[model samples]
Target: MRISAVPDAADVDLEKIDLFDPLLYSDGDPHPIWTAMRQRAPLHRQVLPDGRQFWSVTRHGDACRVLSAHREFSSERGSLLHQLGKGDAASGKMLVSADPPRHSELRGPLNRMFSAKAVASAEPRIRRAVLATLPPPGHSGPWDVATSAALLPMAVAASFMAFPEEDWVDLVQWTSMAAAPEDPSFRVSSPAATLAIAHHQLFDYFAKHMRHRRANPGEDVVSYLTTMRAGSEQLTDEEVVYNCYSLLLGANATTPHTVAGTILAMAEHAPHFLRHGDADGTRVPLLIEEGLRWTSPASSFLRHAVQDVTLSGGTVREGDAVVVWVGSANRDEEVFSEPFRFDLTRDAGRHIAFGFGPHYCLGSALARIALRIYFSEFLRRFAGAELAGDPVHLRSNFIAGLVHLPMSLVPRAGT
Candidate 1:
């Protein structure tokens, strides 16, 4: 876990170390590593047990620079440290890993589905889905907001993407594990088994749908994908599968975490809810942004450098891996005022919770719409939602969300 020392050793005399054990960040104590790096050594280089060395970008501005600067540091090498195995990695291109011209080609079609007008049109269906899943009024005792939120978004997102609703939960389980295998809770099986299952499930599912869309086109995103040609080179069956799989994971994992985080934040900041009164749904969207700023779902993305580049006053050599800490950046004091406090009214749109640059999340607009509808309906149905039991956090750093949120749903007056 030894880290290469920073230059001009006299000024910054800091003991260099790996952020933590392989699984530490996933366990929920990123602040100790992030706080130390931000103050003492914002750009620390560390070597891992596997002989892999990476530059840890912990500060706010540095993260943005790495994410936005596509030329120097490339996402082409893939976004995570765990290399894809023979079963999946050998098959096709994952959009998050591609560079420039190729990246644009891969994302072009998918981005159309998230266009403002398209997402806005999906609002009624999304709201109806939310209302359908929510516990009916007068239901007593605690309930898992995470499970509740997680279930609805996956179903709605899958429906929008043309996947059968029956397979929704399993898709979520697979993606959650694939995103953070190091975390014990998310490790359903060995890396190989997880990859194999994901590869088989997603590819087979989309391959069939692609044919169906070609024969009988629908208004959904997958239908649009069928017509796209990536510069006379259309995405192979695997590419379409992986892209759709990524969308499902994105909508399911991140949005639900924000939902649970918003509820927890509201409980803590009861005065805000009191001040807003019955305008909870309107205020919930603001709360969603604030929660995303507070608990960024995709905590970090790993990128490999194509050439030597100096960043954060540190020199990064070619082929070096840089771990950009997204959550740390969202909370950096330089950019945020009282960064830790969950201020419901704070301007959180600028936060890189959904990431930045060309690789920014294409499903972001859709995610916001889902959140607005989720919270809007949630507040409308259950006016005085109170925590009925202790909430548990997910044991994964890559995608943070609640595991179990026990709550009592108090019905709103006249509902």
Candidate 2:
């Protein structure tokens, strides 16, 4: 269902008092707004600039309800605030846009590949990649935390997809463009045009590798996609291409930003890290979970209501869109004591940073492994680190990402 018309000033005026504005996220800290929403209007409705109205589920319980009740809130319609044209190639083909039993069908073949065991097996290689990308011991100066954190995930994803070493930079660029289409550095003409270009480039890149893998299957993910069958049917070319794009985009986007956010959190909240002493492997998992909760890089995901549903705060009509604000939910005071404080001891495992239910992030395990290894290695190399400059956040509301994070790593005194 489309919005009837641009909301009148009266309606817009009501929303203006709250943090429902997407632009608010791009400006600076949205925690105050989110906190107000959680207290005042957990399930708030706001009209977009284009007049489309969506319900924002900010409370933790409400966010979980919206995300987990797939039957009531369908993903097939579209998972973004802006609806895709019916003819758009990725409309329902990407994993995030599919509902069960199609969602289950599509997810089954790839489950083993990203299972706990699989991610664990990849740890050593991920460690090496992290180590290789980190500055050497005596190296010290301004470093881009976002760039540094991005390397291992990109390298691991490229290796998993069997992408050529030389093309890793291209893969990173395309994924960044796709995820941050609103950023001036990545935007080309318009967000739609930028996304379309990025999608096309990724599809073409994967198609070439897929064709090769089809003829000569290897152990990599691309090979698995090319050869795997579901029941009597093979995955359509569209499915293969779009899902490959999904994996590549998913692998590169969230973790890097979270890592950068974690480092910044460490610098800003020095006592949190210092109290635990050096970042040992024992506490890395806790730190990673906290980082994921603190960063929540993949902020909000839109789901269309399949039927009328009543949430804790209000009712949503059928066909209306509801945005599950995972970032806000992660900071819900009701669930997290002293929510804003970045405490490593907090049981943050329940955070929905990876989302929830059917569309929960497929690469979450891999992401956690990458984060754990990267931070462990980071701590070993650098006794301390500090932000050298302000972090520049991505413009898009969907992705809570840092385009640049200038930091200076304090190399171990002896090293």
Q: How well is each residue in 113-228 modelled by candidate 1, as lDDT tens digits?
A: 78878888888787777776677766646777877777777767877976777777777777666655545555647755765676576667777888898789898877777677
What is the TM-score (0 to 1) of candidate 1? 0.88
Go through the candidates in order and give the clash count of each. 1, 0
Error of 1 at 190 (Å): 2.9
List clashing residue pairs in candidate 2: none
Candidate 2, superposed: residue stretches over 4 Å from native: 1-14, 17-22, 84-88, 271-280
- Distance (Å) between predicted and true CA of 406, model 1? 1.7
Question: lDDT tens digits, residues 40-105, model 2?
Answer: 777788775656678888899989988889999988877765552232346566778888887887
Output the lDDT of residue 73, model 1. Answer: 79
Where does model 1 exceed 4 Å of error? 1-26, 84-92, 182-186, 271-282
State each model's C-alpha RMSD to the native. Answer: 4.9, 5.1
Best of the candidates, TM-score:
2
lDDT against the true structure, per candidate, is 0.70, 0.77
